[model samples]
Structures are given as C-alpha cells and as structure tokens.
Target chain A: MKRRDFLKNTAVFVAGASVSVSALDFITPKELFAANPQLKWGFLVDTHKCVGCGFCVKACKTENDIPYEANVTRTWVERYVIKKDGDVVMDCPKGARDGYTTKLLDQNHSGMLLVPEDEIAQAFFVPKLCNHCTTPACVQVCPVGATYQTADGVVLVDRSWCIGCGYCIMGCPYGVRFFHPVEHVADKCTFCYHRISKGGDTACAQACPFDARQIGNLKDPNDPVAQTVLSQRVGVLRDEYGTKPNVYYIGLNKEVR
Target chain B: MKNHVWRPLFVVIAIAIGILLFRAFYVPSDFGSQEQGYTFGYHRLSNEQEWKDYPEKYKGNDYCNECHDDKIEELESAHHGTIPCENCHGAAFDHPDDPEKLTIDRSRELCIRCHAKLTMPSSDRNDIPGIDPAKHNQGEECSECHNPHNPSLEDM
Candidate 1:
C-alpha cells in the first residue's frame, strides 16, 4: 500500500475508535445502579389504618394478571377475631373481597345482617404481603437461583429461570411465596418492582382506599418513607425469624402471628 | 521435534487470539462496572430486556397532579399528603385524555379501612384514631361529617 493511503486509513480508524469510546460515557456506573446507591424500596402497613377493605387484594390480582380465585392470592387480609375466652380465630374468606360489613346471611332481610356481636371480644384486620426481606430466605432457598434480590433491595423471581420448585414458598417465614397457579412457578409480591422503580407506588399501596399501605424508598431522605420510619416505631412480622423484612407495621399487636 | 513443537503452540496461540477477538467485539463496555465483569457464557443474562418485564400500569402521582393542581395543593397541605390520589380514585390509566372516565370512590367502606379501631397497642400508632364505624356514626357516610381533603373534621 502507498504511504499516503496507509496514513489516511490509520487516521480514519483512530477517529472512529475515539468516537465509539467516548460514547460509553453515557453508560456510567450511576446509570446502571452501581454508583447510585441512594434508593432502597420498602413497604409500611399500618395495622391501625387497615379497615379490611380488601382493595389491596383485588388491585394486586388485577395488576399482576392473576386469576381472581379464592385459593390464588398474591396478598390477603386476615380478620383476627379474638374471642372473649382469649382464643384468636383468624379467617380471610376470598381475601375479604366484600370488605367486613357484608351481611353474613341476608335471606329476605330488609336491613343489614351483622356478624354475631357476642362471638368476638376484639377483632382487627391485618393485610399480609411479601416482606421483601433484607436477607430473604426465599432467595437463599431457591435451588435454581431463579429468585434473587435486586440492587435496590427488591426480591424478584426470574420466571424464565425458575423450575417450578416450591422451595422458596416453603422457605419464606412470612408465608408470602406460593406456586403460581397457571405459571406454575414460585411467586410472591415484588414490592411492585416495575411501578416503584419508576416512582409509582405498589398496586396494593395505590389500591388501598384508606392509605393503610404505602411504599417508601428508604434511601431518599426527603421521601415520606424516611419520615415514617424515623418518626414512628415500626415493627416487622415475626422479628424472631431474623429475616430483616423491609415491610414495616406501625400497630402490631402482641398476639399477632 | 521442531515441527511438532510449532504446531501445538500455533494452535494454542490461535485459540487465545480468537477468544480475545470475540470478547473485544461482543462484551459490553459497561460490563466492567459489574462485579463479575463478563462471565463468558452467562453474560447473555445481562440483557436490559430481562428485567424490564413488568408493564407500567399505574400512572404515578405527578401525572395526576399535572391537571388537578388545586386538589394536589389541598392534599399536600393536609394530613394525607403522602397518600397518592390514585389510591382512592383507582388507577388513572387514561384519565388525562378522558377526564370523565376518572372515577372517584367515596364509599364509606373506603374510609373505614383506615379509621376502624383494631387490636393494636395505643402507643405504637399515632394516626388513624380508632372508631367503631357501626356505632360512631351509625348509618352515616364518613364524608357527611369530615371532608376527605382536610380530614381533621375542623373543615366541616
């Protein structure tokens, strides 16, 4: 090759290489969740705030496209009925779809038929969902490595990688995970990963008619989640299990499981 | 002996060069930021599309605030500032273009979800003062006495 041709070719190659290299500046560590470490998603369920509306249950089903069946529930609300004898009876019929005020048996009755008032000493509703633990037992037990925690502290299941093993379902101390009916894979709440990551609240949180459930990013100092965590005394479910669940409950009772 | 030596060494050198060339062109530049860098066969899992499965159905609070500035202002100053508007209104998936489609839920059961007294200890929770909805205001909607926007009952 001629000297002039060789020099011209080398110049073009260098310029092209430099341009391509500089383009990588946009894909910095901050862009890919490495340097940007100020976001940890969490949930707060104020038991005092819950009215057993069951809106959270319906919303989660709709958002996740799960079948609206009694057996298949991504989240459920348990109505704990403590008897006068100090016995606690918890039941959630179809995830409380009709709320707690529906007539128990309204056969040809004009007015509302209430639950027998004498049967209960004290009663309250507790909405349950995935805790998204700091040290998730489900992820640890996932034999196929399908269940993993994201950088932002979200526990997610790679459906494509999951082998339908129910190990995660069994390992979760909070009883959050389950084998998805149709998908046949271990499934649980993701803290509404897609929505929360984009600054939107969880389906359950947004569907809560009474603001009983709220999603918060603990890393953001100005977020309401920070204020709720710092100002209030929040408790987790089964703290003795030591899963370090991110879900916080504001008014947990001693008898609650 | 000389021929035997050159053949195997040349094959090894060629294989090394092939791997280097493949990595140079195929591996993502940003993979350097990841802890594993690029684990040859498993690098295919790094596709952005892998984790982008969930659809963005809920249209966040700011989207609602764009048009409902007055309502947003009222809520921000109220005790329920942190509560997003969609929580009560249902998901406003397409309300911007079709405002009439937006359904505002004013059901009494909606209010009762947070207001009804539970078995929680008094010291643990500060908000949502417990009220037996059946007896507190028998057969009356919560909004009859307290405005949802300001909820302190002083606005009534």
Candidate 2:
C-alpha cells in the first residue's frame, strides 16, 4: 500500500464521517415534533376572579354534550368557602337544571355551597380543568396508546384510537379524564380543539362570568396568559410533581398554605 | 455483470416504492397519540411557576356581540348575559353561518359534562370536590331537558 493511497483513503473516510455528523446536527429531531401551528393550548385559571359560579362546568357540558346522567364534568367549579373557623367548602351540592347548564347565576351563596360569616373566612370559587400536562400521566398510562400529546402541547385523545381501557383515567393526577359510557373511550377536555382550531374559544372560558378562564397559546408571548405569568404572582397545582402542566391558577387559595 | 448488479437493486427499489404506495392510500387510519406539551426533561422548568395559556383563540368575547344584535340583546337580558355564547353552547359557527351542519354540541353529553355530578374514582370519594353524579340521567341530551330556542327549564 503506497503512502498516497493510504492517505487518500483515510481522508475520504474522515470526510464521510464529518458529513454524517453535520447532517445529524443540522436536522434537529425536534423539528419533527414541531407543531404546524406551533401552539400548545392551555389555561390560566384565576381563582380570585372566579365567583364560585358553576358556569364553567355548565359551559363545558353544553359544549361537549355530556349527558346529565353521565354525572361527569369536563370542567367543574368547586366552591371553597373558608369559614372564619377555617373550613373549606362548596356552595351547593352543585344542583342541576335539565342536562347541562348554560346559566351559572350566582344563586350560589355559602350554605349548601358554603355558609361563611366572617371577613377573613370568606369563600371563593375555583374552576378546574385538565392540566394539559406536558408529560401527562394519563398519556403515559394508556395501555393502548390511545392518548396523545399534540405537537403544540395540547394533550388530545383520538376518540377513534382510544381503547376504553381506562388506563388514562387512573393515571390522571387531576382526575379530569373520564371514560365515555357509549363510545367507551377515555375523554377529557380537548381544549375544545374542534372549536379553537376553527377560531373560537372553549365553552368554559367563554361561559366564565368573571373571566376566570383564559385560554391561549402558551407558545405565544403576547398572550394574556403570558402577561399574567410575567406580571402576577401565579402558581400551579402540584408543581413539585413535575408534570409541566399548562393550567395556571392565579391567586390560588391560600388554603394551600 | 452490470445487469446482475442492477437487477437486485432495481427489485429492492421497486419493493420499497410498492410499500410506500400501499401505506399512502390503503392504510385505514392512524391509531394512538402524538407528541405534545413540555415533558419534564424536554422543557424542564427551573422554578415553581411557568407560563400558561388558555386553550382557545383569544379573539375576545366582545366579538360575539359584533353581528349578533338580537342575540346580544336576549343574552344580555337573560341570566347568561355576562356569559359568552361561544362558552355555553360551544362555538356556534353553524348557527351563525349554516345552521344545518351545526357545529354545535348537539348531544346531551355537552350539558352533562357540566351540570352532572362530578365523579373521581382515583381521588378520595369523600375528599374530592364536584357535583354528585348520582342525581342526573345519563340517557338524555341537553336539548331534551332544556329548550335551546328559549334557553329555559320548562320541558320544551
């Protein structure tokens, strides 16, 4: 083997190796995960703003078409009346109308809901929805790979793909996901993807009387949620658990204290 | 020699194309989920708080009042005046545009998702807070109980 021949072969090999490395570096696998709209829809729930109105719960049902008998809530407003004595409670048993409620008038006070009679022991309403977690335990636990995270951070379940195994139901830390009795698939808030995709708001967000529900693209910086997180002292539920949940609670109940 | 060499390569290439074609059209559907959200290691947060967004187009509920003169009046006068139509009834594109292919939540489940009792099997039954699911009927639709035209409870 001549010296020139050996060196030429070595040079070619080095060039090929460098080319492969460059290609690998240039094509980030993250691009494949890129959301076309590049959005992750989520919510910033202001507990302070919520007046314990069951509007969100009602709106979610009216929007999702949940049957009254299912006894399921895609979104629920938990009335927390912290009596001066320090007992946290809800307004009513959350009475019903026909099937779903569009009207969440503040017929709710603190009796069946929460009977509060103190300055410091006053109660507030907190609306809850799917955390739309980044590493959602619900998505992780699905035995049939039914639940999925969208490219833009939205956690979605393909109604067609869901196996109704209830694995997701068990895994959700927030207890928001449920199994559809008829469809037999795990279901939760799609963030109203069908509505939002076509340009609209989630029923819960719209139904909220106090603007307690604010939905936006967490990816977009100009959104009100971004401003809220940037300006206000906000907190998330179970942040220590590390779910990277998208739901933000503004003025979270001091009871967490 | 060239023929022998290219023949196998051509066959392999042909087979690959066939597979591609089969997948493109014949595939019934895709099952399972997709990548979404900020997973722990992927988009790790350095603090107790993070940026959050609402899950809808922030067109501002004010837009609901733009063309809906009569609706705005009724809604404002009704108990739900403060609430946006898009919120309670789901995005009402069909009603506004087509009315037939109504994109509304035409089923009873839409209402049930809210008004029905909340059930959490994983969380402590006593500790967890939500409406009790035992009181409502699972078979009826929202319109069956509440009248859409009048938006009332009178068995319309």
Most accurate candidate by lDDT: 1
Q: Please give, for residues A7-38, the per-residue lDDT of candidate 1 as tens digits.
A: 99999999999988888754543354563377
**For every candidate, what share of the true interface contacts is present?**
0.12, 0.17
- In candidate 2, stretches whose alpha carbon ends up further than 4 angstroms from where it belongs are A1-37, A90-116, A254-257, B1-81, B85-156
Worst 10 residues of 2 chain B by lDDT: B42-51
Once all C-alphas are superposed, what RMSD does model 2 give against the true structure? 11.9
Error of 1 at A192 (Å): 1.2
The alpha-carbon RMSD values of the candidates against the true structure, listed in the order shown, are 13.8, 11.9
- lDDT for each residue of candidate 2 in B5-64, tens digit (9 for 90 to 100): 889999999999999998677434432222333222221121101112222322335665
- How well does each candidate superpose onto the true structure, as a TM-score? 0.62, 0.59
The C-alpha interface RMSD of every prediction is 6.5, 11.7
lDDT of 2 by residue, A82-175 (tens): 5556664443344332322221223444222223233235444566778888778887776554566666566666565556878778888788
Predicted candidate 1 versus true structure: per-residue lDDT over B22-115, tens digit per residue:
9798655533322211111112244324555576556767788788888899888888776667767766656666555777778777776556
